[model samples]
Structure formats: C-alpha cells, structure tokens
Target: MISMSPLLRLALLALVASITGWLGGRCRADVGDFAPCLPVFYRCWPPKGLAGTPICQRFGNQYRFATMYSRQRRSPWFSGYLYTVPTGRRPEPQLAYAEADGNMVPFPPGPLDQKVLDSQAVEPDYINSTYSRGHLNPSLHHRDHEDRTSTFTLTNAVPQKIGSNDGPWEVLEQTVNRTLGEYCLGEAYVVTGVIPYQKDERWLRDHRVAVPEYLWTAYCCPDYNNSLPKELREAFPTYAAIGRNDPNSTEEIVPVNQTAKTQFRGYDVRRMTLDTLETYLKDRFTTAVSVFYERCSGS
Candidate 1:
C-alpha cells in the first residue's frame, strides 16, 4: 500500500465527501418524492393527512412505485401506483428483499447492504416468525418484471400473518387484478396501507418492525367501461376494502369468517365504500384521511 502525505490525504477525503453528497442529492431527485412519480397517483394527488417518509421504488435504473415509509415502525404507511395488465407469471420471492440507496429502494439480485439491514427488516425478521413480509403494493398489480420486483423492499411491507398474506388477502389482490384488467378502460390507481391496533401495536424481531392489525386497500379508476356489470356498479370510480391481519382482534372493522378454510379462517376481507374506509381511518388516526382527491372525480 502507498501512503500519501497528511495534507494530500485530507484533500482526497474532502473530494470523496463532496462526490458522495452530490450522488445522494442525485439519488433523492430521482427517487425521493412524488414529484417524479405524480402519474402513479389518481389525478396526480396522493393520499393526504398521513405522515411518513416518501420513497420512490426504483429498480434497474427506473422508477417502479412510490411508498410512504415510517422510520419508527420500519414499514410503509402505503404504496401508490398505477395498475398494469400483467402479462407474465409472478416472480419467485425469496425473503423478497432489496437494497436501499438513500431514499430509493431497488430490487437488485444481490446481497443486501448491512446499513439497510440495520434500518429495516431483514431475512431473519420473518424467519420462524408468525408474520410474513406482506406487500403493500402487490406484484400482481404491475405488468413489467422490474415494476413487480421493485415492490419486494421491506419498507413497502408490513408484518402480516401468513393466513392473510397468502389466503383471503391474496384472493383480494387477484380479484382486483381481474377487475382492473377487464373493466378498467383507463388508468387504475391503487393505494394499499395498514391499520394499527388501538392500544397495543404488535412488533416483530424484538420491536425492530411493527405488525399491523389490519391491511386496507383502495382503488381509484377514473374511467372505466360504461357497460359495467351490475354487481360492480357501486365499485366504479372508487372502492375500498379492509382485511384482518390478526385473528384474535375484534370484529368491528373486519369480521372474522368463522367458517372459512382451516388455514384462511379469521382473515376475512370486507368490502366497503371509500367514505366508510376513510371513516375508519379517521377514527383510528383521529384526523381526516383521504385516499383520493374528491373521490377520484377527474379521469
């Protein structure tokens, strides 16, 4: 190894710091806020009255989705994106992880950084745990391989029970995919989030990540096939639903289906109007929670 003079070493260190700072700025510009991803939101307006750090999910040098992350909970408040008609089968998820670069979360096929493991959930957070790393923005909603993989980041996930993650909630995601794929003529914007318990918030891996009490999802389809099916008439424009993540929880919000399959029982999902969803949200957070502006009036 070659040793430089003390003065030269100090000058090199300053130059490296300046370059790192500039790169961080550039990374934020690309994947820090919703400004670069307004098209993902309905009417270019995201949900209001929620507090969290925004992360633009990028993969392979492209923006895939937007997630509002909570540093305290080490999870996402919600993930908003435009629906795409899927063309291929779902990608295999292995721990379904990502590497974080500043505010950007990228799903590269490589080992995760130790710094990322320090801040968010790692493979061990869910290993042997009762909860799974449930995705807020399910890969079923996107068409591109990269877009689908971009959602694997832990920041966009919540600690959801296995039954809900792979059972009824999975059905809900598939149903939405079929509905949006067929009836939605234009863009279908979706926002999926979680609801915490009133008194006791569950945590995973010794409080490293919080487990949600419920998982809620809402979609805004500004324009759709006018020949809508009668059963889906009330579902046009905007619709919302909530699913139970914990079976032992109360049945006020999402009632448990006692007669469900052995594995999927107690993880029932309830469909409701957007207003009703917001009402529950307001009740929990004690403030207004709007998923879409003016109920997705604009196309």
Candidate 2:
C-alpha cells in the first residue's frame, strides 16, 4: 500500500481530533453564543440567539462552505460562503439533506424525522407548497462545480415566496456577481439570512419548516478596486439588503410597489449600507444583529 503524505496525515489527525472533541460531550441546544468552526477562508459574523447546529458543508469529502442551521425551524438562519467569479457553467440542481456527523443515515430523498437530527427539511417540504426553496448562499457566487453543487442542500434553504425568489432578489444576486467579479480584487465573504415575524410565525404546508418574513444579506469585501463608478459607491468594504417575502406585510421597511407587474409586485429589495441594515435588524429582532466585526474596516 502507498504511504500517506505528511500533510495528509496531519489533516486526518486534525479531523479525527475535532470529531472526537465534538462527540465527547453532550450537544448543547441552547443559544450559548458559541462560535462555530468556519472554513479556513471564511469570516465569522454569527448572530445572537441563533440556537442551531453549525454545519461545515462537506461535499465530496471537502469543505465547501459554512451554515448555521436551526433544527427548530428546519431551515438555515444564515449561510456564509466565499464569493468568486464564475468560471464554469452552472451545475444542475441536485438537492440533498445534510447528514450531520453521521446523525442522519440512510440518506435519501424522503421525509425527515425530528428524532434523528431534530427535523431537517427535505424535498417533500417544498412539494406543492406556495413557497420556493430559496438558497441563502446562492450557487452563482462560487467558481468550482462542487462548490456550486454543494449549495443545493436543503439545510441552506428557506421557504421563500416565488415573487421574491425570481424577481428583485434574483436581480440583486446577479448584480452582486457582476460588481464583485469586476471590482473586487480579493475574496468576498457573503452572509445571507432571514428575519422572522414580530409576533405570528409562518410555516410551510406541512408546518415542518418555518417561513421567513424577510431575507437579509450582507457582504464583506476587504480588498477592492478603488476606482468605482459613482453609482456603485458604498458597495465596497460592506453592503446589505432586505427583501420582502410577504406582500401583505407593512411598508415601513421595504415598501411595496403597486404599479409593478402583478407577479413581481411587493417583492421589492431595499439595499443600504451595513450600519443601516443592522439598525433594521436590531429593531426587528429586538437585539443587535451584527453581521461583521467593525463593519470590516481597517484603520
């Protein structure tokens, strides 16, 4: 048999050590504000009171991205993934559920049992439902085929309205791709998450997954080209947006457009600076939702 290289052996040992440490004790379900293990290239901006399992998305035995998943809602609160200009064609959608540390076995397309991994949303959760399976870390930001494919997991999705998913939200995602692809000289870190209603919580058809009222996304790019178009200013370093998921909701945050087409109405996306986004989040969540450290600034 061929011998393992020194670097490979060290990596294997580290992975074994991490697994042992995680399995050594009882898993805590409370929101203790513990930092989850992020991929080597990622930046952490974990929100408060996010009581969920932190999943380092593994695809083909390689770490693809990071996500903070909530088993209670059976959806991800947010997913942090690095952004790179597209070099290959987009991969076909192959959705699957995450097998958390071997907690979920016999993995196949079917209903999820809460007892196994505290209830993960599966393909059936979206079937015939009014909402679409919206991805937090969209596939368009990655360059590798596996990275794009890894984004199809149900754990990284939320119950998003079709209007928002296909309308302005999609435009915003495409705009980000173009902007970063052209100006950003270095890696871009994107954190996309959802906001719950103030009082009444919405759920899917089967009531197995919770639906978000608004989808919020923020990006931190430390290095970027200084010569940006006047219209594209305030985009570098950090920027954020909040998209409306409910048509009947109030217009205080994201106002609905009455003159727009019937299908795309009320799914407006309001873009703003990072501080303004946090203000809205603080008011909505009743606590500070810091998306980046020092707003990704360097003095």
Candidate 3:
C-alpha cells in the first residue's frame, strides 16, 4: 500500500478516491496521510505522536486496515484496524514477497527495492532467522476472507520471538477476541505497535530488520453491553497490554514468570491502563504517543 512522484501521486490519489473496484481485484495506493482510509479508525481518529510512513492497506481493491511503517528499521511502527467477531480456523499467512512498488512475481531477491524501502527485502532478511513474522494486526482479529488475508502483508509485520508470539501473547489475543465477541455491541478499533529497546537494540542475523523488545496492543469499544462482570468492568471502553519479546530483558516493564510452563515462562504479557501503556510508549519514543482519542472516552 505506497511511493511515487508528488504530482503523479496526487493525481493517483484523486483517481483512486473516485474509482471503486470489486473486492476480488487489486488497487493499492501509499498515501502521505490517512485522509482516504479514516473508516479504519475509531471515531475516524488515528493515533497521534508516532512518526512513520502511512500505508492504506488496500487489498482486493478495498481498504481493510492501516499500517505505519518504518523505513530505517524495516518494520511496522504500528497497525490500526477495526475488529469483528472472527469465524472459522486461522488460515496460512499469504506472505507478499513483492517489492513495495509492485509485486515481484517469483520475487527474485536480487532486485533492489524502492518506496517501502527494505533494500535488503523482507523475505531474505528472515531466512533462517531466529524470529517469527509477528503480525501487528493479526488474522485472529478479523472475520472476512479478504480481511484475514489482508493482514498477511509484510508491511504489517515485525520481528518477534517465538516465546512471545506463541505464548502468553497468543493467549492475550484470544482473551481479547472472547471479550470483544461477547461484550462489544458495536465496532471495535484496535491499534498494535512495538517498543524497541532504547539501548543496545537487537537485530536479526542479517541486521536487515530490527527486533522489538516489546509488543503493545490496545482496543477501543465505546458501545457495549452494560452487564459486564465485575472483574471485567474496567476493560472498556479501552484496555491495553505490553508483551515481553526478550526473555533476558529486565522485569521493570513486564516481569517474567519464572515458575510458568517451559515454553511460556519468560515471555509475560502485562495488562494495564491505556495511559500506562502510552506512558511507556512516550518514554521509549521520547515523545507523547497516544493510542486512542481522549483515551477512548465513551461519552
């Protein structure tokens, strides 16, 4: 979903805005702003204070989600989308190995990239790498065939450790699904991002992709049933969480549970107030990072 000439880009944006295509076709446009895809956000408001290139994730000729991507880090800063109650089993991720400007059929690793600017390319960077292709806007959160498949794009992923991707973090996602499916009576908006290590940051074997120290997610559901259980009363209209991606990381952010099962022991996910998550995000990015508008006020 984004780069081209300024005048040409503006013309294309105008053209795409006027033309509507079928859900089975392809029409992608990488915009400088979120002007055309405001529906993906809650109350038509995207998160503010984080910096990255904007990608209107257009798949099957439709805008399904938005991704804020980092060129230098070659990973997504965050992905924002509207959530629906999911059905059926999860499908395989249809990894797009294309160069950002166009799909590189057979995707030769030799051709250099432009626009999306992973010159080293995403596929080559992760070959035999220790990390997993963690989805910032995961498939487990969407329902339609195209919506689920749209979440598979490379621009929407990051380098995540196996423990964090498949452990408590996975459980957290499922919990959110159950909670939202049961309580949320209207549209639910979610934004998931990463917290990179401030010092001595880790990299993949090729150093082409940066690995995050933590993965953060928050959801806003302003409309919901009033009969929430006492334990889950405070979970809406907003709730946030941060998961540890490094087992060796200190316990200050997310303390590791040492006595847990072998696979899930060190990778802990901490659920906290949205303000608390933003506080840590601000501290890490050295700027005020807001996840939801007015902290997802239901008023």
| Candidate 3, position 280, lDDT | 94
Worst 10 residues of 3 by lDDT: 22-31
- For model 3, residues 105-163, the per-residue Cα lDDT tens digits are 23345664554344323666777887889999999998997788878877888988888
lDDT of each: 0.82, 0.79, 0.81
Error of 3 at 254 (Å): 0.7
Clashing pairs in 1: none
In angstroms, how far off is 146's CA in candidate 2?
A: 0.1
Q: For each candidate, what TM-score against the reference?
A: 0.84, 0.83, 0.84
lDDT of 2 at 193: 92
Predictions ranked by TM-score, top down? 3, 1, 2
Best by lDDT: 1
Per-residue error (Å), model 1, residue 155: 1.5
lDDT of 2 by residue, 1-299 (tens): 87999999999999978854653332222323233334222334444445577777777777677778888889988888889887788887767654655222234645546564456887767899899989998999998998888888888899999999999899999999999999899878888999888878999855689999999998888889999999888898889999999998899999887898899899999999998998988898787777765677632
- Candidate 1, residues 108-210: lDDT per residue as tens digits? 5568677666667776678898888898998888898878777777778888999998999999999999998999998799999999888877898888898
Please give the RMSD of candidate 1 to the true structure. Answer: 9.4
Poorly placed runs, candidate 2 (over 4 Å): 1-49, 100-118
